[model samples]
Target: MAYNFKNGRESVGDEPRSGRPVEARTDNNVQRVRTFEHQDRRITVRMLAYELNLKRETVRKILTDNLSMKKLYAKMVPSS
Candidate 1:
């Protein structure tokens, strides 16, 4: 057989990518989150997650890290 299973397999292809970031954390996703926040300046992280179909933590990361935004006094605003 071309690909042996007894001892070892013969396969030559691209290396597996286990350290790559998930699609949810890509730049495109960040931009999408930015757009949503722009529409509603007071949107909460939990609300954003629900609207964008992402996890609360992921949305928080996108908002704080990628977008440079923060929640202050129940408002999503740009952090200086």
Candidate 2:
């Protein structure tokens, strides 16, 4: 003998979705700078971002603020 509710409702437990999408970083330049520092190699921002799996803005920030690459570039420019 099987027992059933008067409404014949089926019990379904709440389950988490397994197909959720992962968030992707939008800035690639920032990631590029990070990759260069990590790998200790010179590479284009585009390539660095691709390899580092980060946003470009992140790489750009690192190069400008943390690495001081922008300062280096400024010093390289001859005084006019």
Best by TM-score: 1
Candidate 2, lDDT over the whole model: 0.50
Error of 2 at 53 (Å): 0.5
> Ten residues in a row with the worst lDDT in model 1?
1-10
Model 1: clashing residue pairs? none
Predictions in order: lDDT = 0.82, 0.50
Residue-level lDDT of model 2, residues 1-80, one tens digit each, is 12544557466554457773344433454454555565644465556556676666655555655555653442211122
Worst 10 residues of 2 by lDDT: 71-80
Per-model TM-score on C-alpha atoms:
0.68, 0.39
How well does candidate 1 score on lDDT at residue 43? 78
**Per-residue lDDT of candidate 1, residues 3-67 (tens digit):** 46455765656547888456578877898899998888777889989988899899988888888
